[model samples]
Target: MLSNFLPFLYGISVFVLLILAAKIMLNGFVSSQASLKTQNSFSKKKKDDRTGLVTVHPELLNKDGCITDEDLLTVRFAKDSDHPQSSENPSE
Candidate 1:
């Protein structure tokens, strides 16, 4: 009975190792494929000279040594009409 159990345990270990090896190989293959696809797509795109160009105004930079807080813009959201205020609790 001991000899029979030893072979069964060995078989289970070998099966587990095979599964782990297959999983690692599959992950590597998938990552490599994804990297290759990204490289190919990037190469197919046309390089534009103005694509990454940016224009900045010199006045926006701080002239003094200290930092100044400039009020650039203000944004306000309009109230939604779908959810009307309940008059049951007027104090709230």
Candidate 2:
């Protein structure tokens, strides 16, 4: 009697696992579609040259929404040295 019931138990467990897998796949697909829907709606509401994500600061843009010619600021960091700057053992 026990041997005869084992096959049925295995079939039920396999069916349950299959159902769980299907639910996981469906959830992923639905969440992805929802994200796409939100992104599309956001772009449709904005409708601008800037695609994807746009910065909140638009002060640099001109009347045509293009950046005007301007000087770029550059930053330079001091190079690291293993020996002290005042070291007298400088190798010639």
- Model 1: per-residue Cα lDDT over 1-92, one tens digit each: 99999999999999999999999999999999999998788778855444577545565557773443574543445874565444356774
Q: Which consecutive 10 residues in model 1 have the weakest lDDT in total?
A: 65-74
Each prediction's RMSD to truth: 19.3, 14.2
lDDT, residue 76, candidate 1: 46
Candidate 2's displacement at residue 89, Å, is 34
lDDT of each: 0.75, 0.79
TM-score of each: 0.47, 0.48
Q: Between which residue pairs do clashes occur in model 2?
A: none
For model 2 the TM-score comes to: 0.48
Model 2, CA-based lDDT: 0.79
For candidate 1, the TM-score is 0.47
